[model samples]
Target: MLLQTIFYVAIAAEAMTAALAAGRRKMDWFGVCVLACVTALGGGTMRDTVLGHYPLTWVEDPYLLLICCAAALITIGLARFMEHLRWPFLLLDALGLVVFTILGCDVALEMGQSPIIVIVAGMITGIAGGIMRDVLCNDVPLVFSSELYATVSIVTGVIYFFGLQFGFPGEAVIIAAALIGFALRVAAIVWKLEMPKFVYDKELR
Candidate 1:
């Protein structure tokens, strides 16, 4: 229950950021809300489906839907404050990645998944929603951006994987991962850190 609550709050904040970005693209009010909800929940839905859970978490809990709706409304109303949205979005994204990663790994661990498989599943769940959001928004997603995005997820996932092995409280593992991920993300952004990219060479026809 605690993890779920944290997930909702992180997603809600992320939704607000997404809505602000979507507004600049001229999305209608309804469209904005849709984007927000989709960005917030799309990944978890996919994670649950991949794990063979029917109905998904949000579907089973109407409170999740209600939370999404509330997030959408709040985001739409705050559209004029686009400048301040960036920090919160980045923060939420990092925190969400860590929490989701831990939750995914924890779920897999409970389901008897092997350590390696659990880590992979956790990493996937961490970044899935952001990927969906970026694709839908027609922008280059953060994960694809050469930033420290996926690195954060993988690191946190690994942390959760090992922490659970040592019998750490699941919540503590999650919180530790979240803090690390969030800090790494913020540091990367602040330092303009990114993965090196290769320059594509065009051959003469």
Candidate 2:
């Protein structure tokens, strides 16, 4: 029950941040809602579609769409105070990333997917929505350039998977995974820790 509640809150947090991004681009109300939905739900939709999991999450639970839209609209109304809430949103986003990854891993595990595919699904669920949002907003996806984003997701999924394999209780594994993942993200942000970059100065055929 608590996990499900946090999942909903994370969805709203994602939508609110996406709403702020849409506001930066001067998008209309409808555009805001659209962007919010994409940012909040796009990752799960893609994960499910790729896995052939029927009844895409929002399709079966249409209220999730309403939640995203509501969050976006509320964000617009509270835009004035949002600047001060940047760190809060960042924290929520970090939590959302781990939570989404765990849930994605759960879905794949339930399907008896291979270990690698399970981890990949979690990574997709963690970062793909933000990628879509950035692309639609004409910006670089943060996961491609940011500090330890997808790494955090992959690590979290691996931790959860192996812990469960080692016979840890499900709830204990979740709490441990979420704490470690969230801490890693916060550390990355504070230290600007990042994967190495590859720079190609020449054009290749």
TM-score of 2: 0.98
True-vs-predicted CA distance for residue 65, candidate 1, Å: 2.1
Q: What lDDT, from 0 to 1, does candidate 1 have?
A: 0.77
Local distance difference test values of all predictions, in order: 0.77, 0.96
Write model 2 residue lDDT over 1-205, tens digit each, in one string.
7778989999999999999999999999999999999999999999999999989999999999999999999999999999999899999999999999999999999999999999999999999999999999999899998799999999999999999999999999999999999999999998999999888899888
TM-scores for all predictions: 0.89, 0.98
Q: Among these predicted structures, which one has the highest lDDT?
A: 2
> Highest TM-score: which candidate?
2
Return the lDDT, model 2, position 141.
Answer: 95
Expressed as tens digits, the lDDT of each residue in 1-205 for candidate 1 is: 8777778778787677667767778888788777877777777778777878567777887676667667878877766675765776777767787777877777777778888878877877788877887888888887877678878878888877787678998778777777887788788888978888777799979
